[model samples]
Target: MGVRALMNDLTGSKSDKSECWMSLRAPELFRVMEKIDKEYALVRKDAQKYIEKIDFNKRMLEVVLAEATVAYQEVYKAGPLYARIPGGLPLGGPCMMKLPDTVLFFHRMKLRNDTFLRVNVLHNDMVNMVLRAHLSVYGLHLKGAYDHTTTGQVRGTLVHTPTAGELGIFLEDIKYTIEGRYRFMGDRLVIELIVSTLSIRNMALKYPNATDSDPPVRLLKKNMADFRTGLKTDLDKWVQDYFNGYLIVADLQDIPSLWKLREYDQYKTSKLAAFTDLAVARINKRILDIGGDYIRVPKFKIVAAYGLVINIYDGALRGLDTMYRRSVATTVFKRDNLRYVDAIIGFKDLEVSYRYVVNFPPGPLMPPSLTGVLRMSAKDLTAHLSLGLLMDPEVVELDINFINPPGPDDITIEGAANILMSNFKHILRYEIATIMSNSLMYGVGLLRTLPRCEPFVPGMLRNTTKLGKFNKKKTLSTSSKNSDEARSKESNYTRPQRRHGTTVKMMQDIGTK
Candidate 1:
């Protein structure tokens, strides 16, 4: 084939341009080839250095990406958390029971907004009249329209303040029936409600005595029936939105670092380490709220459920002493669980302390009075954790049952008081163990917030393999062996002895060369 045809066949190009170029530059091509061949030896000599530099840059890029992946994972997990409210919280605050200010704030906001939605927007009176009209068509007339008085005792400062207290709502003489069920949506619990009974308060409806046979009454019933599904749907949506938007949401980004320190008292030392001059320069900014004063992340968290639920954190468990002190100072636990215990049973001056040191030696299960302190063992903490998955707490009963009824003078009642005090220790131990186990399980999978997968970076896979227990042990052993070998090599060799003048002469000879 001619050169043009041969070139086309080699490159699979369907153009006459290659043939034209070849004809015009054939001589120049030969000269260029010869020059390139002459310079090839020089280029080859520096190629190894360029290759090594490229490899170093590539490894650095991989490391940066891997670290970015880890940061992303941590930030993601810190965002959304699931909490389950436990069943049967005490009617009155008990010793050691505490809530965070932020938690109480959100809860109050939820209740206030919910009240506004039902009372102002929906108008319960109007809803009751509609129910009355619908029921009249069916020949079912009630004695009175539905209504009740709601009284709530909310003991707390304004929502922004850093104080937590109880909110007790009492509904007296309810005239309407609300049938509701709780269900889980993904990891969240939600309530679905239906108002089942017509009101007993609104008694002046115009069609109070209309029968199903009446055309107007039948038509009213039909319209109400058509909208019943839509009404229920809207109520359910509002409930879910309240939970998702306000109730269960929390900012937990500080938790990992807080847990690492194990207690709030270590915040200053940790902050100093984290925000040293060198660290500040590298990060390009100083951190605010280093003392956690203005931080609004609640140490205690709650989520809606059929029963009370809470997300227990490592910081809270470790910082029990702080909580205990605060509770005492504020008298948050001053309210009695059994109001009649003192007046009726003659039990007086009941005092209890919730302060505890975790992982402390197991010396005594209960301490003597005036030294009402108990040391919690680490082994006991872990053992109770195994029982977390097994317990599905539906109803919690808190009863200070007497091991033996207080015998007369048995203060004679001081001995009986000690027995009561000893049982309190048992209850405290059970509670602490449950909280610790739940927190540990949260780290693994009870609330696995992030996916378990290695970052898709070049070096990340190697790092993941190194993170394994066996691989870590192997690396440590190899490093120790290599270090030992290095020490032995140093010991085995000796420097040639030289006279001071000879050493000076050798140094002068080297400098001259």
Candidate 2:
């Protein structure tokens, strides 16, 4: 009441006091407050947009998973039997070793068998979807930060982290192709899958700014280099493991050289043998359980052989032209010391191949002789070749032809043939294992490298305003409490004032009373 009365008395009216209060507020402050409100509205709008984008990406991921599921079902229909005997052999049969009349014949048969074409189609589609999703997330992050810079908006600090579009540059214009070939050799069905041209150099070149010397760029480059190295190493290891797995067949073990190779178990070779043993056992058990009368063979003799050959064409070597000659002069080639030279140098292409073979006994519809099997008419042989063999030929030979005939100086045809004959089995095993391992790791790596989409919430982007409101409330409450405490202390310290002559009178009155 005291302050209000004093203000009214001085100003002459309550309306005058209100006018004074309004005059005291600066116009600039009101304008600044208005600008802040507008900025906040913009921030909210941006956050809403980001949320919508995330929801769209989530839907895309669901679609991708659905497609992948359908593809997996097709592949699953064949069962583990297809993986074990990739060459699409009948239920019970001896292994087909010789090269068929044409590679096309086996390829067509594989399509007709339980091995589904839809599997490959699904894989390709899934990969593309994953890649697109990763890019979309990354692009959003970049745009959000860049928008803040242009509009003078203060997004949360975490959003400002520069992504620089590294993943986009790596994946752009890159294609994933899977080529499969099926061949029958010895007691194994050779299934070969070639995944062609996975590299980032071309994409990197396209977007030079993305690979600038920034910290994020440097880190990404280092990670990619390490991944590439790991892939090559893992590919080699896979080749070894897969080869050992297929070599578990009883007939193959009879080779003296193979027996000696098996003794090198310093690197947990026992684990490889155990894995193959378990796999083979499971396949046999499944056959017996399902194909009771259909399978008349004493036992299912089948081998799944896989091979991976990564042919790396070196651009640097191409430029040097004479580097191969120089290396040959300086380096001594040892037969036992098999090492990959292409890995040390960058490769332009990678070739992968896998093979599976199944062996079954002669059946009512199938003959025991190869000649008899091949001699049957088209209609009769169709059923036999499709399900069983009409004839079992005693002698089947593999004819080798060179695409580009080698000169005598480089390597005689006879010498090349001899070398191939000596190392064919070993090479086949190594390639198969490497390809399988590489494919497995490659899929895992692709998934791992996908960028995560951060959830878009209002708090994430508009944190500054929320924090400001909290701080303002805390400041107002603390100031108000301090002012009340100060007033009380002041009142306690000051004595009550008496009238001009009341000091002496007050004492006299108190005495009289």
Candidate 3:
């Protein structure tokens, strides 16, 4: 009677149209349609929120990327590449000879050129004694009066020059050079040097039993080459002994604003959290194979492939000096002072293997990745020309486990519980990848700033201050001025004394008259 009857009167077909109107009025049908409408609206709202969330995450990532780029540039600008080795030979520098016999020399020497290291052997009594004892068979005399010229070169007359045969050996000049790679063995830093070149001159044999059969030029060449080869062998041995059993310490500074990012407004913090979650998820999914060890990121591949192993035991976070005393494990933190975030990390033994490729195949070779070509071998010329490089794929294996801390500045039981609840491994992996990638890039920039060649300067071997002589002269002048003033004052007082004595003499004469 209600809407159904009205629809029937209008259409003039009561049966068909009436049933349609009646179906529309049913409660069950009305409920189903309403439920579908409500669900559709809710889904539409959720879809809009999801799109916005994605856009927000993208913006947050962009900000982090920009900051990382700037930090990288700044690290490079700060000059990390320069070698921190002493610029010149310091006084009392330690030196030791390794080849024929182990002998320690007291005198320090400085590098003059790549092939020349200037040393004062004759003046150093200990060095001279050792050389005379060892080099007597070669007719070389270390005991001789020598003059240090204004140019800092040692010039002297040979003591055995007259006694030696017509073609005697003369030590024309002694120099040294460093010619090996700087590398790491276990936890030690090592470097070796070898006598790659030598300079010698021939002299007439003056002794009675001098052999005339051997040509002077040929004899000199043979003797000098032998001496150099022997010296190089000794030097290699000395370097190994010196650096053996030594530990290298790596000090890394704390990040100042790492934890502050969490204290932002609700919207901003939420966006950052989403971004971090996604980043962690992506890293965990990769499961990269580095050398033999599986790691979360590929950047660590360089360390494994290149024998650069980070020994955590040798490194300490300087800011947490007090924390280390409490517990070695507790030294690593999740957050500190509401401003710093720490990623707990553990390292396994690092393995690096290298192979040089001298020859290339007939067909074209595949291009290498960024981590693959970090170091190129100069020995492979064919590989360089044909395939753009010459080295076997370096195998690096480093096993690492990252542990997440509970909260900001929390290192107690509650924090540990929190870490267990939140997927700690995933969070730690993300944090480590972020920190290490930036560190590696920064290190490369630093290496680029090192000087290509040793700097050559006369007084570089010693701490020769320019103002030393001037300061001495100034002191002498001031002392002389004070003495002159005292002398003038004494002369004036002596004249007055004589005048007073003359008056006394006149008074005595008047009394006698």
Query: Which candidate has the highest lDDT of all?
Result: 1
Candidates 2 and 3, the one with greater TM-score = 3
lDDT of 2: 0.21
Residue 123 in model 1: lDDT? 13
Worst lDDT run of 10 residues, candidate 1, spans 323-332
Estimate, for each residue in 1-513, the C-alpha lDDT of model 2 and write its tens digit.
487664443333333222111111112222333343354444334433543445532332334334334453453564321111122321101001011110000000011122211112221111111111111101101110010001012111001111222121122222222221212234332322112222333312122254455433222232232232222222223322333344234132222233222222111223322322332232222222222101110111112222211111110101100001100000111122111111011112121112222122335653222110100001100000000001111111111111111111221122122333332333222222222222222211221111111111112122344334423432322343234234334333221221112211211121111
TM-score of each: 0.16, 0.15, 0.16
Residues 387-425 of candidate 1: C-alpha lDDT, one tens digit per residue: 001011111111111111111111111232334544333
Candidate 1 at 276: error in angstroms?
A: 48
Each candidate: what lDDT?
A: 0.22, 0.21, 0.21
Q: Where in model 1 is the C-alpha error above 4 Å? A: 1-113, 116-164, 167-434, 437-441, 444-513
